[model samples]
Target: MAGSAARELSFLTISFDERLVEVGSNKCRDAFRELFDHFAPRLKSFYLKGGSEEAAAEELVQETFVLIWRKAALYDPQKAAASTWIYTIARNLRIDRLRKEKAMIYKEEEFFATKLTTHETQTDVTYQNQMNTQLAQAIAKLPAPQAQVITLAFFEEATHSDIAKRLALPLGTVKSRLRLAFTRLAEMLEGSKQ
Candidate 1:
């Protein structure tokens, strides 16, 4: 009985090893399917035992199989059994996933560490409010034609050609109006600062 069990074990190992070699040489889907069917469940169990969540374990299994398919040509029976090589791939993939997760967490912690505080947010809002008020007063003092072009170009984000088409003016007339509007607004805002 002991002799028969040893023979069976040896046969199974050789069979899988041969199948893996066939996959490398021939790109045989049938052999790959058999390997996947045999190892996927066991690999999942291994990952679960290693504290991976169900989803993460499933991902690791998928990544391992993909690598197996891609790197089958690199396998050497003299270096390791097929099972040992496959499990090593899974282990390395798990380590990579953990490193990426750790990096994302570190980035989040760094962003929070340097984030603007409530006081800074309030001061920014106050400064923005003052600028808006001053800009509104300056715009209100602009002549109607210049104000119209400024409103269309800056507020409505219209192109100069579009503003000329809308206002039934020449393109050069539209450009001059925008330039004059900017100059007047700058002078008004500069005087307000004093």
Candidate 2:
């Protein structure tokens, strides 16, 4: 009887282990949803304290979920809770957005400085005008979508994801457009150099 009891306990333990594995597989959505429902408000509070408006905070929350969905396969249950993983995604995305915004501001400043220097030189107005005309002609030759992508990426210093969101495009489409645009621009610039 004692031997049978031991055998029954071992079988029960094995069954529980299988059940745990099934639960692990099935629990991703539930885990993510619970994590989102719980931590979204906390994330909003964090963003608000960091000076984001309510709308921006909400947008960040949505972006965080999107990232979490994309990266859910990377989550390791042994390493962190779902909440920790989600918060880390949120924090990292916020940092990336802030850095991009700062870079955009810096680029604007540099462009302004370059314009000032160009104006002050005034020594080759005709040559500069010719170069400008060439550049305009090259840009005009690009397809409309390519032109638009280049404008947003270079002139506006928009990130690929930002441009994708702004243009209501997929991130893959944005990346492809930008790649094709750069290839075309490089070919044009290289031809002009010859």
**Candidate that would win on TM-score:** 1
lDDT of 2 at 47: 66
Model 2 segments beyond 4 Å from truth?
1-28, 101-194
Residue-by-residue lDDT tens digits, candidate 1, 51-118: 68899889888988998898888765544457656755775666566687744554333234335332
Global Cα lDDT for candidate 1: 0.70
Q: TM-score of model 2 relative to the true fold? A: 0.37
RMSD of each: 29.3, 25.5
lDDT tens per residue, model 2, 2-81: 55755564444333323323335664555556556656787777666555789998898888777666655554433333
Once model 2 is optimally superposed onto the true structure by TM-score, how far is the C-alpha of residue 181 displaced, in angstroms? 51
| Candidate 1 wrong stretches, greater than 4 Å | 100-194
Per-candidate clashes come to 0, 0
